[model samples]
Target: MSDQSVTDSRLDELAETFEFFDDWEDRYRYIIDLGKELTPLDDAEKVPEYKVEGCVSQVWLLVAEDAERPGALQFRGDSDAHIVKGLVAVLLTLFNGRTPQEILEFDARGALDRLDLAGHLSPSRSNGLFSMVRRIRALAAARGGQSEPTLH
Candidate 1:
């Protein structure tokens, strides 16, 4: 299977996983658990330049071209807030290790909505989530392609 299919399937799996929880509390705990699974970033990587702007919490994101893949990128990110970190994980699952054109073509907000987070997240948190998405797409654009149409 191709890497692009993996990205799309991962998001589908996440939505399925979320569906197992009947309540927001359980879903929230699951989200936090996902955050715990993120590969921790070094202190140096958390510098100002890597910090995602507009986030209520201190969030850092790094996107690098995958050494083995011609156009695909790998994402690394973290956040001070547990929920935000989980959100970063979700974004990484959706966008990481894919080409700029692939990232540009994915429906990220639709995936977020599928996870049922769109209306549940607080305004600040939701804004922070979009900020992360914007940064990821901006990185993709910088790599030499236009991003997908914005859903918001």
Candidate 2:
């Protein structure tokens, strides 16, 4: 299977899992648990250059080409706030290990909406989430890794 399908399936799984929760509190805890699974970034990698601007919480994202996957990119992110960190973790699970074109093709807002998450977020958190998405896309674009369009 293609890498994008794998990522998409994970998003589907998350959406399904979220459906089991009766309230936002349960979802929040589940998201927080996902964040807890992420390895904390080293203090040195938490520098200002990687810091995501326009977020209420401190967020930093690091993206690198996946050596094993050739053109794919892998992400590492961290946030100071628990819920925000969970959001970062969600983004990572959604976008990591995909090629630049794949990243560009992904509809993050739609995916979040499918998971029934977007409307529940405060304006600031929504802005911050999109900020991280832009950062990831910007990094992908900067790498000059754009792929040629394929004919269906």
- Top candidate by lDDT: 1
TM-score of 2: 0.91
Candidate 2 per-residue lDDT, tens place, 34-113, comes to: 99999999999999999999899999999988988898899999998999999999999898888887887787778888
**lDDT value for model 1:** 0.86
Query: Model 1: per-residue lDDT, tens digit, 1-120?
Result: 977679778987998899889999898898889899999899999999899998999999999988878779999999999999988988898888788878877787888888878688
Q: How many residue pairs clash (N, CA or C atoms closer than 3 angstroms) in each of the candidate models, in the order given?
A: 0, 0
Taken over the whole model, the C-alpha lDDT of each candidate is 0.86, 0.86
Of candidate 1, the 10-residue stretch with the lowest lDDT total is: 143-152
Q: Whole-model lDDT for model 2 versus the true structure?
A: 0.86
Instruction: Compute the lDDT of residue 40 as modeled in candidate 1.
Output: 89
In model 2, what are the clashing residue pairs, if there are any? Answer: none
TM-scores of the models, in the order given: 0.91, 0.91
